[model samples]
Target: MCSILHIIGGVMNIAEIGQKVAQQRVALGISQERLAKLSDLSRSTIHHLEHGTLHEIGAAKLFKLLSLLDIQLKTESEVTKPHALEMASRSASVSYKTTISPQELEESLITGKIEPRTISHLATLIDELPLSLIVLVVKEISQRHKIPPKKIWSHIYSWANQFKSPRLAWQ
Candidate 1:
């Protein structure tokens, strides 16, 4: 998954922002042509966005695009710092039925064990999980998939803030 900041960060370069937009559009199952028609942007613009070559897109258009895909961009000023995560005990684990061991999951959460290639898949998975399970799954995937701990935590923090609930349920 693209970083939440990939779209929301004020300091992101054009290419990075475009990539985020394209990624979310794809995730939402919209084709470039369809997105162009919906956003009233040119097909060439959509193509450029997916290709990360769009020089400039207006803020309204960008916001509309993300909104259409169910992404809400929030600046740092609009969000608060995250409180510490309250993880569930191992006995109260959420069942993903993956081959990963509980011990491995615990270790990864403690010591950022990210595997880059798996980040996108993990992001997709995390999106569908209940809020109670998201933190654990993200931590597990980030550690096993080798994603940067700070980056994954930022995504979780933003999500937690968006939902107006910093506390996650494990049971």
Candidate 2:
């Protein structure tokens, strides 16, 4: 009996929390998309919350919207800061910004100032160039500049395609 009591006492239940949020949304008869627009959050966020994808949404953003809609966030003294859920949510929100442009990355390649391997790594991370697009850009630069860009272009192309922006989920 003591073991059963302990198991029930220590369990953290978030189902009631989720239900409360859904109840509010349903009371207003507002769709997830509409709530997203009103809260300046992505539609997926509202969808995930209603469907109980709470792990994908950060506690900060979730509470933010709850506050906007006059909903309260409750805790049983078991909550902790900076959960994995928060980190995952933040990953989807990060945008890519590069120090150089596609033209510059290609120019560095053509000038022989950059190693082929370095260019490959940069292409994967540049986001703007991607792999296929990088090849086109590099080929154009190599042709106009009289550089032997043959296999290098195709190699980079294959490698760049493998990268998937994890942040795109939130976008």
Task: Please estimate how well model 2 matches the true structure, expressed as its whole-model Cα lDDT.
Answer: 0.50
Q: Candidate 1 lDDT, tens digit per residue, 1-171?
A: 433643232444667667777778878788888989998999999889768888888888877776776665556531321221223222223343333334443443455453444333333333444453545455555556677667766654554454454244311
Top model by lDDT, which number?
1
RMSD of each: 15.8, 17.4
Q: What would the per-residue lDDT of candidate 2 be over residues 1-171, giving only the tens digit for each residue?
A: 001111132343345455666678777777778889888888876776667665655667766777766675433432322232223223322443323344445544444355444443453443442343443455455556676676445444444444443334212
In model 1, what lDDT does residue 101 have?
38
**Model 1 deviation from the true structure expressed as Cα RMSD, one decimal place:** 15.8
Residue 111 C-alpha lDDT in model 1 = 55
**Deviation of model 2 at 147, angstroms:** 73
